[model samples]
Each structure stands twice: as structure tokens, then as C-alpha cells.
Target: MTAKLEKTLGAVSLWGIAVGLVISGEYFGWSYGWGISGTLGFLVTTIIVAAMYTCFIFSFTELTTAIPHAGGPFAYSRRAFGEKGGLIAGLATLIEFVFAPPAIAMAIGAYLNVQYPDLDPKIAAVGAYIVFMTLNILGVKLAAMFELCVTILAVIELLVFMGVVAPGFAISNFVANGWAGSNEFSFGTLSAIFAAIPFAIWFFLAIEGAAMAAEEAKDPQRTIPKAYIAGILTLVVLALGVMIFAGGAGDWSKLSGINDPLPQAMKMVVGHNSNWLHMLVWIGLFGLIASFHGIILGYSRQFFALSRAGYLPKSLSTLSRFKTPHRAILAGGVIGIIAIFSDGVVNLQGMSLTAAMITIAVFGAIVMYIMSMLSLFKLRRSEPNLNRTYRAPFYPIVPGIALVLAVLCLIAMVWFNQVITLIFLAMMFVGYVYFSMTKHQRENAEEDLMLVGDNH
Candidate 1:
């Protein structure tokens, strides 16, 4: 069975899905970097990361346009490197798309708690999963429509948040003990930058998720490229705007290391118990929900793609009456829910489960980035005559830069997020082992079902 993702997403809807998948990163996650490197230092790292994402997105567009498959990187790497490479790419996509929701769910819970302070965050998170997963199962069209609605509202919310915090934005407040919190750079400061890299990357982590929906997109060749490019630029600008304003609003450290970073920044201007603060917190839920919902859509398609190709149980590839990947959606939701309560994240040693999950998700993203870029180069050389509607502009240079930055990002994560990275590697190893043992089973697949893209 092939992935039956409804091709209801046009370029605008695709933009919404792409930006929606990552807007929460703007609203949360990145603030954790402030605790690591302070404002000035994180700003430096964010600039470098924005540059990397710009390059990566541009290079990745070619793959999405040329292949136009729901499997995204799995399709790219599978065609280029066969089963072993396909497993690595597909598993990493799973980690990136699957693990991210729990983190976003935690942020959703945190945002609700900021507003009410009585509702348990975990309860709210589970409720979010229930609500969004139901919507996802109902239909892909409805899900994409909802994605467009919330994504627009979330963008407006961020702009309004920046407006509310703008008057408090001061250069002096921003630089106060900003450089590694010591007012000077040291070896420790350099270490902090490395630690801060993942959070910096969080600003645009899942924007590439739009590519995962290529099979469900209208005119995938044209719409996918436009959506990916538009989505990345939008994220880069908004990330900078929110980070700069939020950091300058007041004692930025007060907002550091928190899941509800936007609300914390709002409280600096409006007071802790201000009505505006409460409203801001309420509005923040849309950002979190947009990502939570959008990524659920992403991971399901990926799961469908893998299962359809025999990397997973083919049963998961079956579509529901509504034609959405219902079983796959539910499977991913179950995994994320379990992750919320999972204290047994082995190799994190003593790391907080939330931190470990986020780090693992980022690790997955880095791996896909490297593997996908390599797939791009390999395809260019190996399949020179393959059909192509678009080619990466800078060829070797753009992808070359994205590749080097991806490796650097991986090294940074390994150096700083040791236990979490270890946990991620352990998961990958287990997946490879399972794939190894199932090698005979994989070989029995029909040649027709082995083809990439949604055409099967």
C-alpha cells in the first residue's frame, strides 16, 4: 500500500504547514540558549545558524522538487544509497518528526500553566495530543486547513508579542552581562557557544518538515520549492525579531531555561499578574499547537512512507476511511505520549527527560541534514540524467556549506549534549540491529512497491 496523503495543500497552505511546524521553536526552545551563552553570545550563534539554514533549505529544495515524495529524506537517501542508507535516513526522520512533538507538548503544557497555574501541564499536553490526533485522523484536508488557520494566528501573535515587548527593548538591558554572563569571553564562553548551538538551531529546526508533505501538495514540483524557500526566510526573520526583542525586554536571564519564554518576556513589561500577560500566555498556545499539530502530520507521512516500503509493518501504511494515515498517526502519538513519562532514557544518566528528548530530536535533525545533502550530491553525480524541474543554484558550494555546517552542528551536539547524543546513537543502533535481523524479510518486497515517491 502506498501513502494516500490527500493532495490538498497548495503553496500558501504548504507555507503554513512548513512555518507551522517550526513556529513553536520561535516561541520557546531557543530561550534555553540564553541560559547557556547569554544574549550576545546566543545572538552570534543564532546568526551563524540562520545562515546555515538558509543554505540548507535552498539546497534541500532541489530534493523535494525533484523527488516530490512523502518520505522526504527517506526517498532521497533510499534512491541514492539503497537499504542501509535508507534505514538511517528514515530512522533519523522518525526521530526528528516523532520526538519533537513531546517537547512541543511540554511547552504547550507550560504555556497553559502560565495562564491558569492550576491545570497540570501533563494533563494539558495529553489533551492536546488527543485533540490534534483526532483532527489528523479525520482527514488531511481538514488538518491542513486547521494548520493554515492556527499558523496565521500564531504569526500574528508573535508580531503582537514583539509589539508589546518593543518599548522595553533596550540595547543596555540586552548587553548586561550578555557575553557568557561574565561581560568577557573566556574558554568557558567558547564551550558555552558549542552548548548553545542546538538551541540556536531550534529557531529553524523543523522548517524542512514541509518537504515531508510534498506528496500531499498540489503541483509538488512548483509548490514545494516555493513553500520551502518562503518558509525558511519567514522563520529566519521572525526568529531574529522575537529573540532580539525578548532578550532586550528586561532581565533576559529571568526568561532563560524556561519553556514559556515568550510569556516570561511579556511579564517583564506587563507584570507577572497583568491581564496582558495572561492574554499573551493564552495566545502563545496557538504557536505551540500549530507545531504540535503540524509535526503530527509530518511524522505520520514519514511513518507511512517507511511502512509502505517494508521498513516497518506494512499495516501502518493502510489509510483510514478518511484516507489519512490514521494508524501511523496514532502510533506516533503513542510513542510521544510514552516519551513524556519515560524516565528510562538510557545514557542520559541524570539528564532531565525533557532536555534529553529535545537534544535527541535535534540530533536526528542534524543527521538527516547531513545525509540528505550527501544524497543530493550523490544523485547529481550518479543520476545526472534524472528528471529535474529545479536544480540547486550554487551546486557544490551551497550544499557544501550546508554539509560542513551540519557536521559542525553534530560535533557541537556531541561535545555539549553528550548523554543525550549518546541516547540518540543508542536508538539508531537498535534500529539498525532490527533492520539487520529483518534483512531477509526486506528482500521479499515486490519491485513495484520498492519505487520511491507517492506513485506506487
Candidate 2:
């Protein structure tokens, strides 16, 4: 018998997981947008991306509620377009979920290194993988409870950050060189805005990851819509608030390149020695930990779901005594840990490892988003009679907007980051090769089962 995941998540827990999966964005990664597009330009990129997410989530909820599958996008695509489409969506999602954690984990290490300057960030990153993977392996309920606690603290800390920095915020500082490559909008500024797409995406990248938890959610059809809608609203408010406040607090350019922009921005307002700065560092960790821990859970579930369906080795589908996919959890951790160590050695398009990883993850996410929206549209026509507790408001228009924005983001990313785009394509090619090789085996197994049934 297949070992199944326990349903212990309520709307609140699902919301926590949704928000927590991407909260690290508020703390870091996104400042890189400021680097490429400046404040105003990146703001435009963010607004576009935010709109995409808002629409995507609303439409995505329909599929999540209807299917209530752990495979998330993979399951949706499989039902809509069959095994090949499932392979594409599953691989894209796996890449997104697996690659995102290392980038977040590295940021976690960077946050810790602020307090203990002597400690190596990579070691701390590996430690995080070990700790969170263990927590997830123990049980989903325990992992989600911890995620909720940290997510709440992280949200509060971000509010405090905005409050404390509000007084120091200056319109002049924020708008200074607000457009990348020029003070005024031009062709260059347009290029910069497009270049900033991935970082802008960083703000709300994994919000759709909530769908992965549908199989484990209590009254998922009802609870998931609530959790998803609320989660996106919360993230948009926080992302806008944090970015605007952080930019205006000081010379936004100075904060653009670093991983721990929140703490650095706070120091400009509160002074390096102030208690508020210290609190931001310690409390700020909750935000990073929340994302790091939550994404671990998300990726492991994807692994388990894929493996259980024979997309991966079946060993990964085996649940621990605690009713968790321990092997899957460990498998993703091993990948993330390997990525953490590959930091300086592997550079894509002259970008730092963290930036490259973020870009790669965004690449996966965009592909998955495109596939998911297509799946949504296909199912709407193909299975019109399918029960949907929550239909996407505005139908074609809503999902159409999401599909357009996702394709645009992909175009911008591929345009600006050619090398990383190739790398991403290479990864997909490899996954496809594996899938093709395994397809005949799966078909044979099915035929054998049919034969046995005939004899019986």
C-alpha cells in the first residue's frame, strides 16, 4: 500500500506555509532589482510581477481546489496534456523548488554571519539544511507549526522594520538615479526594467507553492482559496512596504548588492550599535528561516509526489514511521547542500552563485507558471463538468493575464541572462531524457498488470 501524507493543515497553517515559502524575499534577493533597475524602474517591474502573481494565484486556486493533488502543477499538466506535459511541469517545479532553497539557505547563512563575523556562511547554510530536513522528516504537522510560529514573528519583524525606517525615509534618496543607466526613462531604462524581472519576481516567487500542500490541507477546496488569496495580499503589501521603506531609508544603491539588505538598511536609520539594528538581525533570521524551512517542505513534497507517480525512483516515495517522505526530504537536502558548497566555484554569466541560483529558480518558476496556466485553460475546456469549488473569477481574462505576464517574464529573463537560460534548458533536457528512458518501463509495467488481471 502507498504511504499517504496526513491531513493536518488548516487555512491558517496553509497561509503560513504560503507566506513562509517566500518571506525571505522581503529580507534579501530582491534588493538586487535595485541594482539593475534602480528604485523606480524596479518598482515598475515589481508591480507587473505582483499583478501576475495576483492573477496567477486566483486562477491557480481553481486547479488546486479541483484536483487537490500533491503533485500540484505536475498533476494538473498530466491530466490536461498527458505524460510528456507532466514531465515538463514536474521537472520545472522540481527545479524551482530545489534550486530556490539553496539561494534562500545562503541568505540564511549571510544573516547569521552578520552576528558572528567569524563563522563561515556555507557551514551555517549546510547546518540549516540538516536541521530543517530533520524537522520535516519528523512530521508535516510539527514542521508546519514551526513554520507558522516563525512566519508570524517574521511578519511582525518586517512591520517593525518599516515602522522604524519610516522616519528616516526620504523621497530624494529613493528617487536618486531611480532609473537604471539614466535619471530619466529611455531605451536603456526599458532594458534595465526588463533585466530586473527575475529579482522583481523574487519578491513573490513561491506563493503558488501553497498548492503542493493541498493534499495535506483540511477542507482544501475551501481553505486553500482563503489561504492563497490572503497569502498573496499579505505578500504584496509587505513586498511593496519593505522595498519602498528600505529604498528611502538610505542610499538605495548601497543596499542593492548585498544579501542582508534589511539589516543594512536598518543600520542606516538606527546606527550600527542601536538595539533596533540588533533586533533586526536576530529577529530578521525568522524571515529567512521561515522561507528556508518552508521551501524544504515544498520541495520534499514535490519529490515524493513525483516519485510516487514513477517520475523518480520509488525509494523517494517511501514514508518514514512519522508519516513523512523522509527519503524525498533528504534527497532535496542533498541537492541544496551541494549547491550551497558550489557557491564561488560555479558562476553563470558572471553572476554570483546566489544570484545565478535565484535566476535559475525563477526560470523554472516561469516555465511552471506558463505550463500551469495552460493546464488551467485546457482543463476548463476539456473537463467543463469537473467539480470546481472555486472557479477563477473573470475566467479567460484572469488566467490570460497571468499567462501573458509569465511569458513576458520568461522573455525578459532569457534576453538578459542568456547563459543561465541555456543552463536551465540543459537541465530540462536532462530531465526529459530521463523521463523518456523511463516511459517504456512504466508502460510495460502497466501492461504486465493488465495481463495479470486478464489471467485472474
Candidate 3:
């Protein structure tokens, strides 16, 4: 018998997965924006990116409700534009989901290193991959419940961080050198803001990943909209709150270009040995883990969906006795582990591995966003009679905004990170080649499977 995914998730679990998938952005990786754009410039970049995500999610939710497929964007794009579009969307999403974890894993290692100075961050990162991948292979219910627990704790920890640092938030400090090259708005400051798009995008990069769980979500039409709307609102408040407070805490420059910015910001306020600093360092790990674990779920689902559809190796679609996509989870984990270990070997214009990975992931995310918005438009025209439980409020205006911003972000990312952009394109080229080679075989396999189903 062919294995099917169990439908056990509800609105609440979906919400947790949504928030957890992107919460690590609240912890680290975003500070790299401060390195290039300074406080004020990056803030501008963040606001623009945040608006894009808000619009994107609100519109993207409509497609998720209408289709409710595990392939998410791949499914939507394939329906709208055919097999080639499916390949593009699937590859972009795989890149985004697969590459994001290594960056988060590195941050997890960095957070642990604060408490255990003797530990090697790389070893810790690899260990995280092992533990989380195992949890994912166990079952969706177990994995999502764990995600909920950590996401709630992670949200609380960020609130506590803001409160602890509230007293030390001086406006003058935050605004000092806020612009990249000057104290006021200029061509240089504008350039810096554009360059900061990827880091700003980091804040809500994977919120739409919730859609990947639609196949397992109960009453997906009703639940997904609730989860996505709530998730986006929750993240916006947290992202703005955390960034403003962190920047105002002290010399924001000190927090830039590192994986553990929150703890360092807290340490500046409460001293290195303060109990609060230690608390933030330890509990802060939950934030990283939330994203790390949740994204493993997201990527594995994408892998399983693609393989089941014959785009990838059929073995990847196999389910364990526990009913989880075991091979898919491990496959993504192996790719992430390779990325984690390649920290120093893959240099991109003197950028840190974390930053380079973030840029590459953001590139994939932008491409996917553009494709998704286009799919939404195409489907609306092609299937106007389709059942859409919850329609996007503003129609073309809403998704139009998302599409335009995504295009702009992609342009900015490519301009600022040429080497990384080339690598991302190269990866996509390789994936397309593989798809072309296997296309005929996949079609024949589908025909044989259908014939067997008819006989049965």
C-alpha cells in the first residue's frame, strides 16, 4: 500500500510551526545587517522587507487554502505554469529550506559556546542536525508539539530580553552612525539600505513554510488562514521590538557580524557574569532550536512531496514505520551538515559563512515569493470558480505589492552578493539538468503506477 501523511495538525500547531520556522531570525543572522547598513539604514531595510512579507503572507494564504498540498509553491506553480515552473519553484524552495538550517545551526552552536567556551561550535552544530533530524523522523505530532513548546518559550525569552534591556535603550546611541556612510540620507545610505535587504528579509523568511504542513493540517482551509495571519502579526511585533531594543542597548556595532547578538547585547547591560546574561544565553537557544527543528519539518515535507511526484529519487518518498518521511529528513540533514562544515572553505567576498548562507537562502526565498505571487495571479484567472475558503483581502493590490517587493529584493541581493548569486544560479542549473534527464522516466513510471492502481 502507498503511504499517506496523517492529518493531525490544527490551527494552533500550524501557528507554532509558522512562528517556529522563522523565529531564529529573532535570535541572530539579522545583526549582519548592522555590519553593512548600520542601525538606521538596516532599520529602513527591515521595514521594507517586513511590509513585503506581510503582503506576501496575506496573499499566499489564499493559494495554500485552495490547494492544500505538501508541495506548497511547487504544486501551485506546476498547476499554473506546468512542469518547468514546478521544477523552478521546487528547486527554489529546496534551496531556501535546505540552506537556512545550517545558518541556524551555526547560531545554535554560537549560543552554546557562550555557556560552554570549551565546546567546538561546529561539533555542536552537527550534533543539532542529528538530534532534530531524529525527532522529525519519529512522527509529525511529536515534532510539532515540541515545536509549540519551544516557540512559546522562545517568544517569552525575546519579551524578557526587551524588558531587561528597556532601561538601557538610549535613543541617541541607536541613532548614532545609523546611516552607513553618513549621518543623513544620501546616495550612499540608500545603497547600504538596499544591500541590507537579505538580512532584513531574514526576519520573516520562512513564515510561509507553514503551508508545507497543509497536507497534514486538519481543515486546512479554515486553519491555515488563522495560523498564517496570526503568525505574521506575531513575528512583525517581535522583529521590530527585538531589533529596536537590541540596537538601543549599547554600542550596536559590537553586536554586528556575530552569531550571538542577543546575549552580547544583554551582557552589555547586565555584565558578563550576571544571571540574566546566562539565562538569555541558555534560553535563547530555544529560539534557535524552534526554527531549526521546524525548518527540518518544512524541508522534509517538500522533499517527500517532490519525490512522491517523481521529481526526485523515489526512495526519498518512503515513510518510516512511524509514518514520517525518514529518508527526506536525513537527506536534507546531510546537505545542511555539509554546509555547516564548509564554513571557511566557501568564501563569498570576505563574508562569513553564516552571512553567505543567509544570502543564498534569501535569494531562494525571493525567487519563490515571486513565483508564488505569479501563481496566485495565474490561478485566479485560470480557475475563478475554484473554492477559496478565504480570499486575499485586496486581490491584485495585495499580491502585486508582494511581487514588486520580491523582485526588488532579488535585484538588491544579486547586486550586493554577486559571487553567492552565481552559486545559487549554478545550483538551480544543475537541478534543472537532472530534471530534464529524468522527465521521460518519471512519466513512464506514473503511467505504470496508474495502471496498477486500476487493476487493484
Candidate 4:
């Protein structure tokens, strides 16, 4: 049976869905990666990542425009490769969603602890998880509305980040740290670019998130692509601004080991004694919380979509009278709690899981994109008159380039992060086996029903 969709999200609302909570992670991840890979010149490293992010989003936008389904990756896989394919995609996507909340909640707790010092970070993290859970369970519309508030706060914080750091601009910090071991021209410089790619790709994720709410979006065909393009462009600009301001505010050398870079940059530039630094830090903290919420919103919708497709448990598929997938939301929250506890025990066992999950999430997305591009090509040849409000520009060329870039990124992730990539693929393999068995049983049951119908 086709699932009923509630029109709780519109074009602007869908845009708000992505803008809210991802900024914190995006900024933090990019800064951390750049700081770690200190060998590459900041500009070269930044450009490499920007290219990956741009191509990844371009691929996702093509698929989203074609399907515009709530399932996102899972739905795309099913459409491309059928039930078993959907199950594998669903599992990979689930890993990302389930692990994200606790990671973010822990981050919230960590940021709070920076200020309070005395606040039990664990309890604070759990508290943040509970609050976010309550918001999600309340329903998607309410979640979207809450997300709107967070998005506004995040944008203001970003503006504050730019305003505070732009003044302290210094070009030397960037140039001083020339390409790692570079004697004019060498592979070491090339290595730096390759090394920085994954972290860069991580920053620009969730660009396709707007598509998860496509069914609910007002004129989804138009809205999803517009939001997709707008959200990605905004984040791209934000990322470049952060890179410039951070590199300028202080030597990248000193920024290491600090969790709140924007505030730290402000304090270094304007003096911690000033009220402005304090205010920006407070705002930065809120932006982090908002980003967490936005991710949860996008991830849960994918879960809901997968469950409804019968690849996940039927219970998770059931929507409430309010038209929200309460069970799936709760399931995701439970996973978050598990992640939080796991993080507490180890340096970041759960956090590692979150990272691994993202790697696999992109892997799955790339695979789906290749298939979706093929589907687009197939449709063009077979179903020429399909009602598509938006066709990918340059036809096969844009989509073709997108597909090639996605494959390249996937290869790089697998090559560099092999162990984690293997674990993720193993998880997907297990899901595939389980799904195949389930399908066999389901077909048998259907046959029995047909026999009974004939006897009657």
C-alpha cells in the first residue's frame, strides 16, 4: 500500500530543515580536519574539499529531482535495484541517522561543559538528547518549526563568526604553512590534497536532506531542487568564510585542541575580556544545538521511508494519527542513547561509529547516484515523455560528471579508510542476506494466500 503523506513541510520549511543543525558539525568537522592535515596550504586543501562537496551535492540533486521520494537514499536504491538493494541502502542510511544524535548531544554537552566547567558533561549530554527526543516525538511539523528557530539562530551565529574574525585577517598564516614537504612541485603536495578530500566532503553533506521532505514540500519538484541548491551554496559560502576567518584570526598551529574555534578566534583577536566574545560563544553554543536538531530531522525521515518500504520493521513504518513515524523516531533516539553511553566508556567508540557510518552513508549515496543517473538515462531512452518539471542540465553531461566524481570520492574513502569501510560493507552484506531471506518468506506467504483464495 502507498503511504499517506502529510503536507507539513513547504519549500521554505524544507530549506529550514537543512539549515538548522548541520552547521555546527560541518564547521567543527572541517576545522578539525584542516587543523589535523596542517601540511597542505589552506587554500589548496579547501579547494579540494569544496570540489568533492559540490559534486556530491550535484549528484544528489539529480536523483532527488527525479524521484523526490521521502525515502531519500533508501527509496532511490529500491527504485534502482529493487527490494534487496533497498534493504542494503536502508541499513547504511540507518547507521548514519542512528549514530548522529548521541554524537551531537555529546557535542552539546561538551560545549556546555566548556562554559560551566562544573556541569556533569555526561548528564548534560543526556539531557540534550532527551530534549531533542521530545521535540522529534512531538511530530515532524513541530520539529520543522523548532528547526526554523534554530536555523535563524545558527545564521546569526555564523554572521557573528564572520564579523568577529574578518577584521583579524592575516595572509601569512596560510602561506607560511606551505604544502607539506613541497620543493616547488612534488607528490607530497598532491598527498595533502588527497588527504584533505574526505574531511572536506564531510562538511558539505546533507545537501540532499531537503528531498526527504519532498512529499510534504509545496511543489516539491521545484522546491526540493531550489532548497537543495540554495542550502548547498549557502554552506559553501559559509565554509569558505570560516576557513578565511579562522586562518586569519590566528595561526592554525594554535587553533588545535580547541573545541569552539569561532569563539576562540574572537577571544584571540578582540580579547576575552570583551563582552562580544562572550556573546558570540553563547550564540555559537546555540548554533551547535540547532545543527543537531536539523540532522535528526533529515535522518529520521529516511528511517521512516525505509520502514514503510518493508525493508525495516513494520512497527517503525507505522505513522501516528498525527502522521509522524513515532516508533522510528524513538528507535533513532534509543540508538542515540546507546551512542552516548558508548562514548562515555571509550574515547569515542560510538563517535567512531558515527564517523564510520557517515563514510558508509556517502558510499551508499554514491552508489545510488550512479544507479539513479543510469535510471535517468534509461528513462530518457524508454520513457521520453515522463513528466519531469526539472531536467538535469546538459542532459547526460552534468549527470555524467557527477557520477564520475562520486565514484572517485568513493574510491578515495575506501582506500584511505579501509578498515572502517570494510566494517560498514560487512554491515550492508548482513542486511542483504537478511532481506533476501525475508523476501523468500514473504513470497511463500503470498503464494499460500493465493492458494487459499483459489480454494474458497
- Per-residue lDDT tens digits of candidate 3, residues 1-34? 4457999999999999999999999999999999
lDDT of 4 by residue, 1-456 (tens): 545567777767777776664576544555545543552444565675566456556656656666667777666655555556556556766665555556557666666776788997668877886787678767778888888777777777787777877777777765456455332536656655655554565566555566677766667777777776677777778877776777677666665434556666777788867788767767776667776777676667877776565555566757777777777777777767776676435442233433444454555555555555555565566545545677676666766776676677667667766766776778778877777666633343212211111222
Ranking by TM-score: 3, 2, 1, 4
What lDDT does candidate 1 reach at residue 272? Answer: 81
Backbone clash count, each prediction separately: 0, 0, 0, 3
Tell me how many residue pairs clash in candidate 4: 3
Order the numbered candidates by lDDT, best leading.
3, 2, 1, 4
The 10-residue segment with the lowest total lDDT in model 1: 447-456
What is the lDDT of every predicted structure here? Answer: 0.86, 0.90, 0.91, 0.63
Question: In lDDT terms, how accurate is model 4?
Answer: 0.63
Better model by lDDT, 2 or 4?
2
Compared with the true structure, what per-residue lDDT tens digits does model 2 show for residues 1-456? Answer: 655788999999999999999999999999988989999999999999999999999999999998888889988888788778888999999999999999988898898999999999999999999999999999999999999999999999999999999999998888999999457988889899999999989999888888888889999989999999999999999999999999999888899889999999998998999999989999999999999899888888899888877778778888999999899999999998899888888777888778888999999999999999999998888778777999999989999999999999999999999999889999999988888778654453222211111222
Residue 364 accuracy (lDDT) in model 3 = 90
What would the C-alpha RMSD of candidate 2 be, to one decimal place?
Answer: 3.2
Of candidates 4 and 3, the better by lDDT: 3
Please give me the total number of clashing residue pairs in predicted model 2: 0
Which ranges of candidate 1 are over 4 A from the true structure?
A: 1-3, 343-351, 446-456
Q: After superposition, how far is residue 407 of candidate 4 from its true place, in Å?
A: 1.5
TM-score of each: 0.96, 0.97, 0.97, 0.87
